[model samples]
Target: MNIHKISAATIARTACLLLALTNQLLSACGKPVLPIESQTVEQLVTAGITTVAALVSWWNNNSFTAAAIQADAEYARLKQKGE
Candidate 1:
């Protein structure tokens, strides 16, 4: 084989061996290679506050409260007519 061909083959074989060794090492450790991104305390607190506010607003605007108020007004009207 030519000198250039021999050198290229050597580099290719070395790269493949390195890749296999790295994979084996990673598997043996039983952990992920990449780091996980973590949320900040401020972000968690803000999310909790936003969730609570949304729930409260939804409850206030729900049909049950509106229906109750409407029933009370109707009852008042009936009482006025009876009087």
Candidate 2:
């Protein structure tokens, strides 16, 4: 058997990348209309904000929240309002 350990930063970055790709893929004809560079930048920003918010919440409540989940919900809300 083989085993590997990944750091939290790596996991967070990977999760953000996957989220961005999935969002793009599901948006238009199974294709990404936006450039890959922009998608990456946007995802990184979202990841950074979510990380900060999660850390603040953890510091206050001693619990961690799922960043991707909240991001998706917020995205949907924004989209519905045509923002």
Considering every candidate listed, which one attains the maximal TM-score? 2
Report, for every candidate in turn, its global Cα lDDT versus the true structure: 0.75, 0.80
lDDT of 1 by residue, 1-83 (tens): 65544588899999899877776688579753432335664787889999999999987734468788898788789999995
Clashing pairs in 1: none
Model 1, position 61: C-alpha lDDT score: 36
Question: Model 1 — which ten-residue stretch has the worst lDDT?
Answer: 32-41
Residue 64, candidate 1: alpha-carbon lDDT: 61
What is the lDDT, from 0 to 100, of the residue 72 in candidate 1? 76
Q: Which stretches of model 1 miss by more than 4 angstroms? A: 1-39, 62-83
C-alpha lDDT (0 to 100) for residue 53 of candidate 2:
94
- How well does candidate 2 match the true structure, expressed as C-alpha RMSD? 19.0
Q: List ranges where model 2 is wrong by over 4 Å.
A: 30-83
